[model samples]
Target: MLRVLTVALVVTALVSPPAAGQPPRPQAVTSLLAGMTLEQKVGQLFVTYVNGQRADEEHPDNVRDFGVATPAEIVAKYRPGGVIYFDNDLHDNIDSPRQIAGLSRGLQRASKIPLAISTDQEMGLVTRIGPPVTQFPGNMALGAGRSTTDAEQAATITARELRALGVNQDFAPDADVNSNPANPVIGVRSYSGDPKLAAEFTAAQVRGYQQRFLTWSGVAATAKHFPGHGDTATDSHTSLPVVDRTVEQWREMDAPPFRAAIAAGVDSIMTAHILMPRIDPSGEPATLSKPVIDLLRGELGYDGVVITDALDMAGVRQKHPDARIPVLALKAGVDQLLMPPKLGEAITAVVDAVKSGELTERRIDQSVLRVLRMKFLRGILTSPPVDPDKADAAVGTPENLAAARTITDRTTTAVRNDGGVLPRRPKAALVTGWGENSTRTLAKLLGGKALPTGATPTPEQITGAVEAAGAADLVVVLTSGLSGSPEQQALVDRLVATGRPVVGVAVRNPYDVAYTSVPVWLATYSYGAGALESVAKVITGEIGPKGLLPVAVPGPTPYPLGHGLTW
Candidate 1:
């Protein structure tokens, strides 16, 4: 038998019944659920991806995958409850904010019910939308700032831009604690290594994302990779990773941020594609493990929409076929199956499961009701078509950009300044390292020459950077993935050997400092334009170093969490 949500939990946890004039009437949700067919109900359980920017445009990938040439045709045929936008090779669903708003309107026009448009706009490395969208340095940057108000402000700006673009759902505020130094996937994506700090930032971001704006109901904030994807050395995108934390360890390390998110009334929680032997020995990933989900539903009391990570990933596909994955996830108490490998097959399998009595229609109704209630609560059902013309005005305004710069400025962490090399204005400087764009930007800002190198620098590139450093009084080297790349570490060592004052700026991972012996070390946590500009200002003594280290860097002498040097 499928586990059903208790009425009290449904009322309190799932629906979050409004105070006065808020929406999602229980009767209206019931009426809508009563009208959906089994196929329609099953369709509501999957959030699929489309290939084109415009709903009416003919795209070859859409034709090949869905037997339809246009997004509108796919929506009409499949009637998916939601669609996620991605800018990958298969799907180029974003161009400009105005274009996205128009596409969203067309897709909603094609569907019988309004669609919940979503994207992974978690800022920093994972931000899907770019440019005219205000770019804030991501979560770890926020973690370094250690200001809950800044975290909320960043989320509020992001929510405004996303809502203006007609996207209503954000897979954001990662909420994972980066306890393991070698975690492959979630490095700077997490807020902090300390659970309590991560928890505080998570709750603040939730409130920011869900706060209603003028004429716009709030965007639905999702606290993701539930149970926790941090503390693992492997990446889930390639294969399943096992986290061996016992129940007590998990509660102490991984559960605090999720718990804080729940108390902050996050609209949804996304399950990770990881297996924990201590939590569930059934060999199923958390996305398909009922026992693991019980920890969220039973122990944590989260009855909100439980969404699975992308179904096409290798983590959840182990030993399970494409069709059976969706069925197992639904049985495991997941409300939404995200980005299934084969959308039609996944939907049909669930419908067939209901027909064969393996899954009941009542169980299907429960999830659909939860989804419908969220759609109603977020004003997706009642809101008018997004105005494409006003999208540019709403997104990336001057005020919002200034706010983003302020937040990024506060996150420039000075991990080490042995000779007080930072906050020094150098007449002649050489800027070189990983991240070509970031190096060029910093060089332009600092009035220095830029010799940009790749993440894994070639020997020739290292020699060229070393030659360039000889002509300058100071050298600024940007490093990324230094822990794994000895060549990049070698480049930093060579630049330091030049006998010039060398400042190593880690633009991606702050842990790069642990692998280098540079006299001066700083972490921007991001290579975005705003972050690089902030780093330049700190180098020139325009601003003091204020950011604390969000994660511990291990070495012969370790830099513990919350360590930073201020001048």
Candidate 2:
């Protein structure tokens, strides 16, 4: 029976609900905005991007030059009320999942209304579709495994593999609160530095991406970069990152996970080109600020759908240029402008600013009636087409890689073992200041020997990994920032001066255990092969390291902010 109602709606989105549900009736968005017009309600406030599925043939996974327009000329001339996908439209013609469900059923069969097709899956390491799906273990390893039912079963298996590839929006649970452990783009895509434990794992990843298909047709989650790119060290995807705190230290650390992702009913939030300037001293960067979208709709009451974040970043493209960032992100109230970098000069500068009154066709029909009321509360206007052969049985389903290896074996963290040097099985030698398939998967999970160093390692590859760590018995470095290079702290000081039991592992910044003085340290906050197979089954003990330090690693171990140990 449709596989027992998709297994009782994936076991009711794997438990963990408790609150926030309401939000869907706007009377089919007031009778579809009383039959739209003004250039189709300014193309329903644009959620643009095509990543080319044949636009005069330029494939190689398209996103970088938008292949000059083809999915029937972006659905017959920018009728984009939504469409996001990337990684060049599912690897330019062959990323499977039935060729991205026939390129999202040919852009919702050349849209007129049913569109909102988004992606940026946010599976560890910001995956934008490419793989047999299910990657999980993101948001600082679910805030180092303080699981909210493993962040609502990894956003209900990444919203049931983005609804079998027709992708009904998921920018994702990055409700940023990494709280600057030198945040250059929300470390471990944040789930903590404790703002009520990143607002209880951002309301358990917005009830695992908007209540995992409660009775069907779902997805839309978002809650991103808003009001806080987690205490920025600048990288609003190239430049503007300021956040100088103060609305009571940003309501005690970046607005409590965007007020628990708008009380967990998050159908979309996004914003944040970072520049709080103490909550808008008119420095303008909360995507062009009207006191930061009126403090997310009059002091965080957030009536959903704000979006912004990628108006071709350089923090709002080095201060607005390609026809003033979609009419100053819809005069800073922003319902959605997402990837706008001259999508026909931002829809002819919002239809020449509503024919020169500088904006106001009833403010573009109140942001295209909040983007057609979140595509009619995510049913994507009565969903149907996009069964490109049930996307190979709804992508990577072994019940979604056993719910992405049970949330990457509960987020791997053993923060500094010190002497017991981690469930030892050694004969190992796997060093990597750069990933060669994470030095051949932690050297075939420790039957070891794979030294590949290049993320700046040459003093004869750090004296050949200090003479292959003097014929290994134990020496596994794997890093992605040990102090981001002096040849990765001269290859972790020549593999901890070859006093062999050295461990290290930080694979993609858990602040590289504050520049390694390693006696043993681990943190698979993402390099993703299911977080390096849960850091090789927590160093061969076959998983037994319930991860903890969800941010705070400054020089010296005592790792703080929820550090982990567990033998």
> Quick one: best lDDT, which candidate?
1
For residues 1-567, write the lDDT of model 1, one tens digit per residue.
Answer: 011122223333434555653444455467567766899899988899999999899999998889989999998999998999998878999999889999988888888777889999999989999989999889999999999999999998898789888899999989999988889899999999999999999999998888752235468889989999988889999989999999999999999999999988787899999989998998999999999999999999987789999998989899799999999998999998899988898899999999999899988988898887777667676566688999989988999999998988899999888867778888888999987888889999999999998888899999999999999988999988887888888999898888999999988878887754788999999999999899989999999888999988897557899999888
What are the runs in model 1 whose C-alpha is more than 4 Å off?
1-17, 20-28, 212-217
Q: Rate the local accuracy (lDDT) of all candidates.
A: 0.87, 0.75
**Cα-lDDT of candidate 2:** 0.75
**RMSD, one per candidate, in order:** 4.5, 20.1
Taking the tens digit of each residue's C-alpha lDDT, what string does model 2 give over 478-507? 878667577877788778877778778887
Consecutive 10-residue window with the lowest summed lDDT within model 1 = 1-10
